[model samples]
Target: MKEITFYLDFVSPYAWLAFERLPQALEGLSYHLRYRPVLLGALLKQHTNPGPAGIAPKRAWTYRHVSWLGHSLGVGLDMPARHPFPPLPLLRLALECSGDGFVNRFVAGTILRHVWQGGADALDPARLDALRAALADQLRQDEDAPERAKRLLRENTEAAAAGGVFGVPAFEVEGRLFWGLDSLPMLRACLDGDAWFDQHWERAASVPQGLGG
Candidate 1:
């Protein structure tokens, strides 16, 4: 079975959407989904790309679009009152559960669900404490868990950038990059061997006349 590396950040609504839909998309497939938590902000900085929410108009559209997508998918998504909430801590927490696929998925899903449903207070001290307690046994295994987690996140982000990733919800299948929640269909197509590229299709030559004179 081939591996699909799913790069994500909790701060992105699109990432949240991908999270909810990926399992179903890959259902009955021979791909193993490996979730890698990375700091989206760092990636954007490295790539010099602006975040969707950074533009006022795009931000407004994103909320509506993501909400509609969520509804269509039957996945509840309530935009956090504070969009772009600090995701560093959450990313670190996710990395703490790395290597254990089930635990990692649970932790990532829990954090994204909390932000999407509970809004800004998703990471309040009480909530964090509760989460920590829930994963106490796993946490106890590492003496410097927090620091180590932070380092892991940084390494993940760096690795992602090096791998040509510039945004959340990116997927890599056999070194082919698919970025965005919308790319799920394309990813699925690739997995099913039905994608256009699978047929050895080549890009048509661009006509110079088509370029601005």
Candidate 2:
């Protein structure tokens, strides 16, 4: 009966890519998922962590690496440059789906697919509405669909911000925070009773460049 709270913003390409593996990573493991929708730009302005795009050299390097990672993961991801909007509406849709006890993996999957598979305009309302229609059709839901979707998005975003989240694809396990989708494997390991958390003083060669407030 362990739990993981995932904080995420829709605008992040890395979050989309990370979502590709996280669901499966949780399989066969005892865990519950709590999704929190937060704003990435707000967090970036907080003087805490910097976005990957801020560092031209590192950003370039990460994109190349992400290309290879996507290939390995069998996920189709458009290059990061193409998708630059926040994923608030989409994440709200996911939360709304969860309320029905039918986690719309398709919506989640489509979000990932659109973001990484040469389909970079996933944030467009038209595209999102179409996706929602398809998902609702799949789920056979017909009541006030648009309104509900909007409500879900707003509520979740506010709740996410209130939860101390400043980024997307963040995972919290019983109060321990794991930011970024790349950290999911570590989160999984921690939940499965790994002792990686017991040690201290695992210092980096330098402070993460943007971590200075």
Candidate 3:
């Protein structure tokens, strides 16, 4: 079975939607999924992007769109009490359980749900303490876990950016990237061995580009 690495950031509502819908989207597939948490800010910085939330109008549109998308797709998603909250705490918390930087599906899903399920404050200190306690039994954490998790997050984010990942909720398989919550169908088509990919895959980058048109 081919391995598909799912690169995600807790800061993205779309990532939560993709994570929720993936099981149904790829049911009966012979692929192994690896959940990876990365810093979305770092990913955007590597690509020189201001991010969707950096713009005023687009931020509003994105929140509205993601809420609708999740609703339409049968996955519940609600904006947290704040937008663009610092994800460092959550990201590090998730990484603490990932020795090889590949988080367990259950762990990643639970964290995603913690952020997306309710319209509460994701950065609330008390909530974070509760979440940390909840996962304590599942993890054999060390006293220096915080520092280690921070280092691991940096390494993972750097590697992801080097691998051409510029955003959250990106699926990487067969060296091809399928991004966005809406790209699940396209990903499935490729995984299903569609003939169209065999014919046109290379043309995406091989096609001639017109300069200064």
Candidate 4:
């Protein structure tokens, strides 16, 4: 079975949606899903891509689209008051509880649910402390766990950037990067060896002067 690396950050509602639906989508498929934590802000800065919330039009459309997607997927997704919340603490927690795949999924799901579904503040220190306490038994039991987790997050972000990942809810299958939550179907097609799955896009120097050009 091939391994699919799912690079995510909790700040992204799209990532939350992907987390909710991916397991069901991948059922009966011969692919292993690996969760990786990366800083979306850093990725944006490094790639010079404007964030969804930073643009007024995109932000308005994103909320509506995400809500519609949630309904389609039968998953509850309520955008928190703080849309672009700080994801560092949650990312660190995921790293601290990283050994077991199930545990990692649980931790990531819990954090995502709290922020997206529960309407809780993702950056609230109290909320983070409560979550950490809830998973105390599962997290790393070292005094330096926080530091170790931070380091791991940095390494993961650097590795992801090096591997051509520039966004959240991205997937990598056999070294091919499929970005965005909408790319899940394409990723699945690639994994299934579908003949129609073409990863290439033709590039042109200038727009054709036919209709709107």
- Among the numbered candidates, top TM-score falls to 3
Error of 2 at 167 (Å): 2.2
What are the runs in model 3 whose C-alpha is more than 4 Å off? 211-213
Rank by TM-score, descending? 3, 4, 1, 2
lDDT of 2: 0.65
Q: What TM-score against the true fold does each predicted structure earn?
A: 0.87, 0.70, 0.95, 0.88
121 Cα displacement, candidate 3 (Å): 0.4
Query: Candidate 1, TM-score vs. the true structure?
Result: 0.87
Give candidate 4's TM-score. Answer: 0.88
Worst 10 residues of 2 by lDDT: 198-207
Per-residue C-alpha lDDT of model 4 across residues 18-45, encoded as one tens digit per residue: 9988877777798777788889999998
Superposing every Cα of model 3 onto the true structure, what RMSD results? 1.4
lDDT, model 3, position 154: 91
lDDT per residue for candidate 2 within 130-196, as digits (tens), equals: 7777666444355665566566566655665666666777887876677776787788888888866
Evaluated at residue 116, the lDDT of candidate 1 is 82
Question: Which residue pairs collide, candidate 3?
Answer: none
Which portions of model 2 miss their true places by more than 4 Å? 48-50, 86-106, 124-126, 137-163, 198-213
Candidate scoring better on lDDT of 2 and 3: 3
Q: Give the number of the best model, judged by lDDT.
A: 3
